[model samples]
Target: MTVGSTPPKTLYQALFNKRMLICICTGFSSGLPLYLLIQFIPAWLRSFDVDLSTIGLINLVLFPYTWKFIWSPLVDRFVPPFLGRRRGWMLITQLGLLLAIASLALYDPTTNLTKIIWTVAIIAFLSATQDIVIDAARREILPDDELGAGNGFYAQAYRIASFVPGSLGLILVGFYPWSVAHLSIAAFMLVGIVTTLLMSESSKPSEVPHTLKSAVIDPFKEFFDRDGWQSAVWILLFIIFYKLGDSMATALETPFFLDMGFSTVEVGTVAKISKTIGATVGTILGGVVMIKLGINKSLWIFGVFQIVSILGYVALSIVGYNYLMLAVASGFEYFGVGLGSVALIAFMAKSTSRLFTATQFALLSSLAAVPRTFISAGTGYIIEAVGYTQFFLICFACAIPGMLMLFKIAPWNSQKTAVEETIAE
Candidate 1:
């Protein structure tokens, strides 16, 4: 099937298949711990008198999410026994995360931030690596028109992960003793490891190239040598700037909520119900919009919406923490995110040459969080520098690059012809 057109395959064929189900389950399992360490953990630490500046600086541990592309080529080119291409690497990384999370549970951050940071970093790194592998598997397996719907499912699972750990866990932490909360989260990690082990590998191990020269060396040369590098560069910038607005708002959410005197239950209520519902509704809406409008125009609409929603955070800083106000703004931002994300993923999928699908997709998708990860690492510092309102505004401003780059790529996004790709410079 062509990248732009609907695939002839049926949705039932993809859904009933065991492989896709495993991909969905494993993807969600691997996804759960992310916000636990990045957003929630930092906020928890602050209650112990952890400095905001320190929290901001310590977020550098998340650098792996941004840099995972460096090793994506390794995953694309190598495979282990028992599992093939994507699945083998998936198991390895997921197992590694299980160990990392357990290690963090054993080390109390109040007592030892040093050890906790290292363990969190380890989990984040492995998780990012696992995402690259799983994404490659989905792109290879799913039908074209179904890609939008598949992304919807992926977001659903990811939002659940975010919800369970962030919302449910937070609710427990507020009511129960620390021991209970830590033990509960650790138990969840154990279940995740078992689920990963029991699932079948998505793709079978096949011989690609035996040597470093063939596997790692040749793909890079061809990707750059063929002059595909220019489009890839533009893509990187778009990804880097796409989520700046929402991210800036999000970076301060926990603190903002706390400052406003909302209990953990209130935050959890949003996570489990409102935020989760918004994400789900937004994803469905995004998939339909993409299908109706097509990738190019949807890119414009969604990208613009993404930036505009940053204004909601500014409103929150002004209006204070009313539940209704929070719900409406969160809905706008997260929903916008869900929509824009579908467009970006589909667009990136269209950009790949089929032969290099695994490597190229990894590179593109990992860049998805570059802006979020980059700005967020310094989130505390930025919060300190300009304070919350200005930070949101700055993030809103950062989104301009998405349009600028998209316009430059308009030719490429519009027509994927050799003639278009090779215009005289």
Candidate 2:
């Protein structure tokens, strides 16, 4: 086949590719620490008879994720004596996560609520740090064309890692002591630790920032310089708004399900399982289509599904209490969002300059998280004002602005130009 008309790899070759294996490792390692913080820690607290409000308040510990960009520059600047810059920080953060997670088991949340908060907060910080490095590594290692497929595998493996803390770890609670369960979870960090030792550092030593100030200042400076003021602003705004509506729509999900008269078990079991399956399928399909259609077109297509999926929640809100309907709605939402996320991540990866990969990627990814971190707080009030059906309808409307912005930031025909530029480089 001609270079431009090369046939796609067979499924076996695609799945067994070396870089794909590294992507899986990166996803699992990056996911485990965060899941331990969100899923396992909350379950651990509830098991100790902690009140719902206290548990909710404790979730504020996840604030580090929103602010991780501040420290991410340091990740771009320094390297440890041994491993290269990316792997060095990855090793440290992964080790810290391992210790911080296990340390949680040492505290009893009922009696040591303050202590538990401190420990889990450390876990969050370490987890966020790990994310910065892992993301940079993924960006650096994958070629321009592979970003979508690489991130698709990353997303799928991330979901699988969630099962460790969300499902298996919780199941272990029934059969084992909390300490043992926490220790077992800690042991899983070894998956990352070993992966770090085995895999070659994705970034080169020469790419390390020459000075710390440049690390902080130049990532921002270079972004604006390359894209210019107007385009840079558009990119930032697009990142913030692209996922906003879906983020808002799902913020009050558990409560919404409960209010619709579905039991917690249905939400916990059926919704979660079906969503996982749908997400896996959607991510894989998105990766394949992205390879064929390229990032710009994939963004337009995946984005439409994202907006359409919000209406599923509206349908579920009206249908009420049907387990089958819940599964269908939740599943489609997950699938659609998964597709959008793969394209979005690939776009962000492509946008970054390799020298500032960690800091720029962190800033962009952090901006994408704003709606989830801040706007989600107001979702309950919005739902209170206009019941579930109308709230989701509002979300469907909110998604439009981002889709419109795609023409400005990632125009449909731009993908071909982007590929041509990559070829020139």
Candidate 3:
């Protein structure tokens, strides 16, 4: 099937398939550890009276996520003794994450800060590695036409998994010892391991990279050679800039809420509700819409929603401390994020060669993470300098460059047949 062409499956048929089931598992497994690091851990540290600076520095451990592509070739080149290549790595990384997360229960942040940091770092590494194999596996298993819906399901499940660590884990900590909460969360890795065991390995590439050097070098070479350097550069730049504004706008969302005089309970309750409902609805709806609109058009339309969502924050900044507005703005922002993320992921999946799936997807996704990991770090300074209203305006402006680049990278009328033709060469 051509990349741009939709399959004739009904919405029910599209969503009910085994492939979408796997997408759900892939997303939940991939999201859990990352959220554990970003959401649960910070709260854990603060509960123990760890200094804000130390807690902030802990974010640096997530550098593994942005550099996972560097080691992705290792995953691509080496198959484990069992479960074939993709499933083998998925199982290994999930197991490692399980053990590492449970190990956090053994150390007190007050007394064993260094050990805790190192353990979290190891978890981050394992989580990032898991993402590489899972992404490649998803790409291999889904048909070209299913990329939009498949990734939409994945995005929804990813957001749902955040609730485990972000909400459930925190609630557990209140009623139980930190150890129990840690172990409870760790036990959730069993879901991933079970999914790995149940899933057959995705179809193997016709030509697997024979050596580490080839694995590392050839994926980059293949991507650049596919459409020449100019197109490749445009795609990379779009990946970086597409979500840059939204990411920066929400960099310190909890602080922003607090600054607006919302209590912790109000912020947590409202955000969890809004994010769950909004992101869930957005992804599922986006998936169904992409069936008709195609990824190219979805990008253009959803890109507009992304820009408008930032303006919602801008409105909130001006209105200040209104609960209804907070809920509306937060929900709308997550909805936009969901739509944009699903479309972007489908585009990235479509861009990769199956032979280089792991490495290429890793590189593309790492570039997407750059805005969140690095550029968002400066948001605090920007907000301090210009205030929230102005900062959001700047974020709104940052989103436009990416949308403009879409005219070249993913034009509204462009057909994926051209991309398929390039890969066929």
lDDT for each candidate structure: 0.68, 0.79, 0.82
* Off by more than 4 A, model 1: 1-11, 14-19, 143-146, 189-195, 411-425
Highest TM-score: give the candidate number. Answer: 1
lDDT of 1 at 227: 55
If scored against the real structure, what TM-score would every candidate get?
0.88, 0.84, 0.87
Best by lDDT: 3
Candidate 1 residue pairs in backbone clash:
84-205
**Model 2 lDDT vs. the true structure?**
0.79
Q: Candidate 2: where is the Cα deviation over 4 Å?
A: 1-15, 37-60, 106-113, 170-184, 252-268, 318-320, 380-391, 413-425
Local accuracy of candidate 3 as per-residue lDDT tens digits, 1-425: 99999659887887789999999988999999987887678677766866444565566677788899999998888889898998888999999999999999999988999999899889989999999999888888888767776877788888899887766776676568889889999999998999999998894655557887798898899899988998788788889998888877765665676668775456657766887788888888887797789878888999999889988888889999998999999899989998898888878877888777788899999898887667765666677778889989999999999899888767778765245546766
- Number of backbone collisions per candidate, in order? 1, 0, 0
Ranking by TM-score: 1, 3, 2
Residue pairs in candidate 3 whose N, alpha carbon or C atoms collide under 3 angstroms? none
The 10-residue segment with the lowest total lDDT in model 1:
416-425
**lDDT, model 3:** 0.82
Error of 2 at 133 (Å): 1.1
